[model samples]
Target: MTSPGLPDLHRHLDGSLRPSTLARLAREAGIALPVQPRFTPGMGLDQALACFSLTLSVLKSPDAVRLVASQIAEDALAEGVTTLELRFAPQLHGGAPPAVIVDAALEGLAGRGGLILCGLYGEPPDLLSRLVAIAADRPGVVGLDLAGGPLPSHDFSMSDYEHPFAAAREAGLGCTVHAGEGRPPAEIRVAVELLGARRIGHGTTLLEDPEVVALLRHEEITVEACITSNWHVGAIADPMDHPAARWLDQGVRVTFCSDNTLLSATTAAREHELAAALPGMTPALWNRAVECGHQARFTRS
Candidate 1:
């Protein structure tokens, strides 16, 4: 099938660093890549997360970062993705100020899509506050994403994101959280009830719990469902195992996304193709997913 012309709402800036560009940037910076980063099936989330260490080398310079953003935007445009929400934690880009990296990325995505700046969980509280302020000030920043992995421990006493989420809400920035992908379904409820997440990044585990699925429908939260990345991130054993189609059937709002184009060597077209192969795949369901994505996209309005 051809590209679905759907909006990709969960692509990550660091994850979209093209292999060719990575090689060029690494050669220019004298940094070496680690074993060609693609999602080897069965790779755990920790392993997948470690791949970004190599990408960080390429992202050290403003020009390199800008190049990545521009290339990703152009790639999305070519693949019929008109709306995008490229995300990345700015502090991870080798000590470059968050604002500068975000600015460069915004310039690359000029007139293309709005940015969703991420603040990784357990990040320094001061830096988190600074990122919220920066996101509030940046022209194309439409959301503040609380992104990180390993889910909260079972005891779940960390309050690191509370103040930041409150501040983001106060500033009128949309909130999305990385939860229920590698974590329990309860995390999704925590994100919505406590963290003010209107969208759940991944949320693969959500189908296992009907209550959470109902909560998702009740709260009107959107899920950024990335089929290929699920294999990479250890969220599912196979792309066929993705619950996006199921989520849609359950009346849960969902949109197909290429979680990491470069990292997964996949595209929005590829993601749509995967979604179309799901058990209940139908033209009507596909159209609904596309419309859900369009409505949920973070426009800098």
Candidate 2:
């Protein structure tokens, strides 16, 4: 909230859990962490991801989930994010029901934002159905998103396109997909055309296919670009090589985000700063990207 304007759309709840809370929960859960104490600071992509296991270890019970969910909203509000789509995989939380996380997030959010139930790439159809049910029942739950590890667990096949995404849409749930990160640009096409992805995560490779770019722009799809997280995950070797600038130049809708603030140790202000530095990026273009997030958010009410 200090510098970046009042709305950051793409933030992960699990990734933004507070350090002090994690330490306390770890102590209670008897989970050992790295010597550094802080979950952030110079970690390889796998290591940063492994930190989630530690977070998941502690965020099992409803009280734990509620506290962490509330804290995440507090941090986002502090970052000037009046509204955001906080995504997390409830199934990853030691069998905690999706309702617990969603309701807790709603309580914490206090109507400030919405929750996006994450369907991890390898999950079975039944799980996504349950997620869709939860989202459909909860008005504060905004949508469904397909996310996976550095490598996508499921290919962009018909089965992948159908299951949760189509089912969720059929049940009135919004859709977004994590594509163009570990997969090819064509997969981004599949996500949009087949799976109904209104937004894309880490869409750095989207420009690899001109046709895909046209489809994205023509559809007015929003790309959530996480510059630091992309470099940390090695999706892009250099932040300077990021296509956000080019996408903006082409009048493509793009939004900057801190994919995992807990792991990346970044804030909306920091993300805006990094986004402004993209080679050939202009201040006007970057401002438009911020506005894109503000305008593209899925607020059902």
Highest TM-score model number: 1
Q: Name the best candidate (by lDDT).
A: 1
Residue-wise lDDT of candidate 1 within 13-98, one digit each (tens)?
99897788888888888876657877787788878888888888778867888888999999998888977888888888865787
Global lDDT scores for all candidate models:
0.83, 0.78
Give all candidate RMSDs, comma-separated. Answer: 2.4, 2.8
Q: How do the residues 1-301 of candidate 2 rate in per-residue lDDT, one tens digit apiece?
A: 4654655667887778888888888888887876422333334455666767767778887778778777878788788776577888888876466677667767777777777888876667678778888888688887888886435445434355476788778766678888888457987888899889889988778888999999999999999898888877777877677889999898789988887788778887788888888898998998899889888787654
- Each prediction's TM-score versus the true structure: 0.94, 0.91
Error of 1 at 16 (Å): 0.6
Clashing pairs in 1: none
